[model samples]
Target chain A: MITFENIDVVYPNGFKGLSNVNLQINKGEFVAIVGLSGAGKSTLIRTVNGLVPFTSGTLTVGDVVVDPRSKAKLRRLRSRVGMIFQSFNLVTRVSVLNNVLVGRSADTPTWRSLLGWYRAEDKELAFQSLERVGIVDKAYMRAASLSGGQQQRVAIARVLAQDPEVILADEPVASLDPPTAHKVMRDLRRIQQELGITTIVNMHHLDLARSYADRVIGMRAGEVVFDGPVEEATDEVIEQVYQRSLTAEDIVTAEATQE
Target chain B: MVTTSTAERRAAPQAATVRPEPPRPSGLVYLGLAGLAVLAFIVFWVIQESGDVLLIPLGFVTLWAPLNPVIGLVVMLVALAVCFKARIGTMAAFGALAFIMMSYWAGATVGFTLLEIPERWSNVEPRLMAFLDPNWSYIWTVRDQWLITISMAVVATLVGCAIGLVLAMYASPVSSPNKGTSQTIKAVNSVIRSIPDVGWALLFVAFIGGTAHGLGPMAGILALLMFNIGIVAKLTSETIDAVNPGPVEAADASGATLTQRNRLAILPQVLPGFVSYGLYVFELNIRASAALGIVGVGGIGSAMMLQLNRFQFENVAAILIALIVVVLLVDMFSMYIRRKLL
Candidate 1:
C-alpha cells in the first residue's frame, strides 16, 4: 500500500508543485493521475519514489518511508519502486541486454556492476524481462538501432527486470504516436495485473486514463480536485478538475481521427 | 497584361517613396578610425627613426646588418591599401594593421635582409651539396637510436592514456564526484599542458641526470608521458562533459551507485572519443619524442645532434630522411585506426 499524508511541495523558486495532497492507494490497483501540463501530475507520481522530494509531508511506499534526507534509504526505496520516462532514456551506445541489466544494478554489488560482472541469475532475470517485452531477439542489438516503439518496449523491459513492488510512469507515451501509446499502456496494464504491483501513471490523455486505470485522480494547479472510480469520472467532473471545457486535443483518439 | 503588371509594380514603389533612413555607424566606429590614424602615425615614426639599420644580436655577440627601406615602405603601403579597400569593420581593419606591424617588427628584430642571402650563398653551398648526397652508411649507425625513440613514444602513449582515462573521470563536470575535485583536476591539467615538450625534457634531464648516467631514454619517455597525460585528460574530459544527461538520469533513477552509473552510462558514450584522442596523442608523442632527444635524452635526435656537432651534414641528412618517413608512416597508421574506430 502507498499513502500520501497532507503533502505540500514548494519549490526553491516558490512555486507550489503540490498542496495538501492526501490519498491511499491499495496494492494491485492501476491508478492514473490526469491533468494539464503544469498540473503536478509528474511531481505527484515522482514523490512516491522520492524522486521529487515533498516540501512538507509524510509518504510511504509499501513498508519504506520516503525520506530525501536519508540517501541510503531513498536509494533503497527507489530500487523497489521502478520509474519509466517519456523519452525512453536508455544508453543508446550499449546493447539492449546491457540496458536491461542496468535494472539489476541496485541489487548487485557496486564493484561487480562497475566491472560488468553480472551473476547467472541476474542475466537470467534480464533475459526474462526482455522476453516479457517481446524484444529478446533484439537483446544483443544496440539500443540506437531500434525504432521508437521498440526502444520504449526495451525501457519497459528494463523496469520489469527491477522486479519492483510499485511502478511509476511519468508521461510514458507523451512522445509516442497514438497506436504505440495504447500498446505501451496495454503492456503496463497487463504487467501490473500479473505482478499485482501498485502502478501510478501520469497521463494527459483522458481517454487513455479512462481505458487503462481502475481509479482516476484528477489534479488542477497543485491540488487533487477529484478522486473516484473511472466510471464516476464524467465529462463535467473532468472539466471541473481541468477548470476548463475539454477540447478535441485533450482526447488522444480524437486527435488521431483528425490526423 | 505583363506590361500592365510591371507598370503597377513600378507605380507601387513611387506611391511609398518615403523610404526609411539608412542606419548611421556607431560612435565606436569613429573611435576605431581615430585609433587607426594614431597607429599609422606611430608606424611612420618608427620607420623614420630606424631607417636602413638592422642589428642582429646573438648570445654575447651583436652583428650590424643592413635593412632595405623600400621593402618597409612597400609593406606599409600595401597594408594601408588593404585597410582602405576592404571596407571592413573597425576591429578587423585594426587587426590587419596590427598583423602587418608585428610582422615588420619580427623581421626587423631577426635582421632579415635579402642582400645577405646572395652574399652568404657560397658559404652554404658545400653543406647543401653534402645534404643532397647523404651518407647512406650512417643509417646502420643510428638505427638503434631510432628504434629507441619509437619505443619511448609507444610506452609513454600507452601508459598516459590508461592513467588519463581515470583522471578524466574526475576532471569532467558531469562524471566528477564533486565540484571541487573537477575544478582542481582541471587547474592541474592546464598547468601541465602549459609546459612545452622541450621544457619538460630539460626539467627531467636536470633532475634525473642525462645520457652519461644511462637514463637518457628514461628522461625522454617521462617528458612525453607528462605531455600525453595533460592532452588526453583535457580532451577526454571535454568528451565526457558532452555526454547525454538523459541516460545519466535514468541510471540514477534505477538506484545505481555513482561508480556503477558512470561506468555503464557515461563510459560507453565517451569510449569512442577517448580512443580517437588516444590515437591522436600517440601521433603527437612520436613527433615530440624526437625533439626530446635534442635535450641530451637518448633518441634519433641525439644521434643527429652528435653528427651535427661533428660537422657531418651528410649523416644528419640521412637521419632526417629516415625520421620523416617513420613519422609519416605513424601518422597514416594512427589516422586509419581513428577512422575505423570512430
Candidate 2:
C-alpha cells in the first residue's frame, strides 16, 4: 500500500509543485491520474520514487518511508517501485535486450554490471520479460530501429524485469498514436492483472483513463480535486478538474473514431 | 542474338513527341577558334625564332640553353590542344607565353647554382660514411635514453588520461553531481589548458631538475601529463554535455545510484568520444615529448639536437628515420582504433 498525508513539494525556486496532497492506493489496484499540463501528475508519480522530494509530508511506499535525504533508503524503495516514462527512455544505440536488462541493475552487482557481465539467470529473466512484452523477436535489434509503440513495450519489458510491486507510468502513451496508445494501455492493464502489481498511470486522454483504470484521481493546479471509482468520475467531474468544458481532443476515442 | 541500332530500337518513344535538338555552335565560335589558333602559332614561332629576330625576348631566350625548335613546337601544340579542350583558350595562350618567358629569364641565372649540389655531396660523402662506420654502436649506447623517452610518454599518457576522465566527468554540467563541482572542475580545466606544453616542460625542468641534473625524462613526463589533461578534459567534457539525457533519466527512474547512473548511462553514451580523444592525446604526446627534449627535457629531440650541433648528419638522419617510423606506426595504430570506436 502507498499513502500520502499533507504532502507539500516546494521547489528551491519557491514554486509549489504539490500542495496538501493526501491519497491512499491499495495493493494490486490499477489507478489513473488525470490532469491538464503542469497539474502535478508527474510530480505525484515522481515523489513515490523520491525523484521529486516532498517539502512537508509523510509519504510511504509499501513499508518504507519516502526520504530523499537517505540515498540508501531511496534506492531500496525504488527497487520495489518501477517507473516508466513517456519518452520510452531506452538507450537507443544499445540492443533491445540490453536496454531491458538495465532494470536489473538494482539487483546485479555493481562491478559485474560495470564490466557488462550479467549472470545467466539475469539474462534468462531479461529474455522472459521480453517474451512477456511480445518483443522477444526484436531482442537483438537496436532500440533506435523500433517504432515508438515498440520502444514503449521494450520499456514495459524493462519494468517487468525489475519485478516491482508497484508500477508508475507518467504519461506512458503521450508520445504514441491513438491505436498504439490503446495497445500499450491494454498491455499495461494485462500486465497489472497477471502480476497483481499496483499500477498508476498519469493519462492525458480521459477516455483511456476511464477505459483502462479501475479508479481515477483528478488534479488541478497543485491540488487533487477528485478521487473516486471510475464509475463516479463523470464527464462533469473531469471538466471540473480542468476548469473547462470537454473538447473533442479531451476524449481519446472521439478523435480516434473521427479518423 | 539480335542487334538493333539504339535510335531504331527506341523509335516508339520518339514517335510520341518531337523533341527539339540541342543547338550547335554558331559560325562566330569557329571564327574565335581560328583566331585563337593563329595567335598561338605566332607566339610559338616567336618563342622559337626570337634568337635570330633580335626581338626583346631574344635576350631572355638566349639566357639558357634554348629548347630545340622541333621540341618547342611540339610542346606549344600540346599546350594549345589541352587549353582549348578545357575552354581556356585566351587565358591559356597568355599563361603559356608568360611561363616560357619567365622560365628562360630565371633558369639562366639559377642554372649554375644547381651544379654546386653534386660538388658538395662528393666532398661530404666520406664524412657521412665515417660517422655511420661504427655500424649502429652509437644507437645501442643511447638505447637507455630512448627507452626513457618512450616509457615516460607511455606512463604519462596512462596516468594523465585516468585523471582527465575523472576531471571531465565532473566538468560536465549535465552529468555533474552539482553546479559548484562542475564550475570548479571547469575552472581547473581552463587553467591547465592555458599553459602551453613547452612552457610546462620548461617550468618542470627548472623546478624539478634544479637539484637532480639528469632527470630530464621526469620533466618531459610531467609536461606531457599536463597537456594530456587539458586536451582530454576539454574534449570529454564537451562529449559528456552533448550526450542524450533520456537514458540518464531512465537510469534514475530505475533507481540506479549516482555512480551506476554515471557509469552505465553517461559513460556509454560518451565512451567512443572519450577513447578517441585519449588516443589523439597519446599521439600528440609522442610528438610533444620529442619537442620537450630540445629544452633539456629528455627525448629523441635532445639526441637529434646533440647530433646536429656536432655535425653528425648520419646519426641525425638515423634519429629522424627512427622518429618517423615510430610516429607512422602510432598514427596507423591510432587510425585503426578510431575507426573501430567511431
Top candidate when judged by TM-score against the true structure: 1
Error of 1 at A24 (Å): 3.1
Across A140-250, the per-residue lDDT of candidate 1 in tens digits comes to 999999988789889888888889898889989999988878888888998999889889999988999999999999999999999999999889999999889999888
- Scored by DockQ, the top model is 1
Model 2 C-alpha lDDT versus the unseen true structure: 0.83
Q: Which stretches of candidate 1 lie over 4 Å from their true place?
A: A10-16, A254-259, B1-35, B43-49, B53-124
Off by over 4 Å in 2: A254-259, B1-154, B177-180, B203-218, B311-340
> How far is B336's C-alpha from truth in model 1 (Å)?
2.1
> For candidate 2, what is the DockQ?
0.46
The global C-alpha lDDT for each of the candidates, from Candidate 1 onward, is: 0.85, 0.83
For each candidate, what's the DockQ?
Answer: 0.71, 0.46
On residues B1-342, what C-alpha lDDT tens digit does candidate 1 reach at each position?
Answer: 545676788888887679875444354664555566556546655665455656667989987644544455456556555655555555666676677667776766676657678679999999999899999888888778988988888899999998899899999989998899999999999999999989999999999977768999999989989999999999999999999987887787888877888998999999999988888887888777767777988888788888888999999899888878887998899788878876
Instruction: Report lDDT (Cα) of residue A105, candidate 1.
Output: 87
lDDT tens digits by residue: candidate 2, B23-67: 443445445544554564456556453443212246647444434
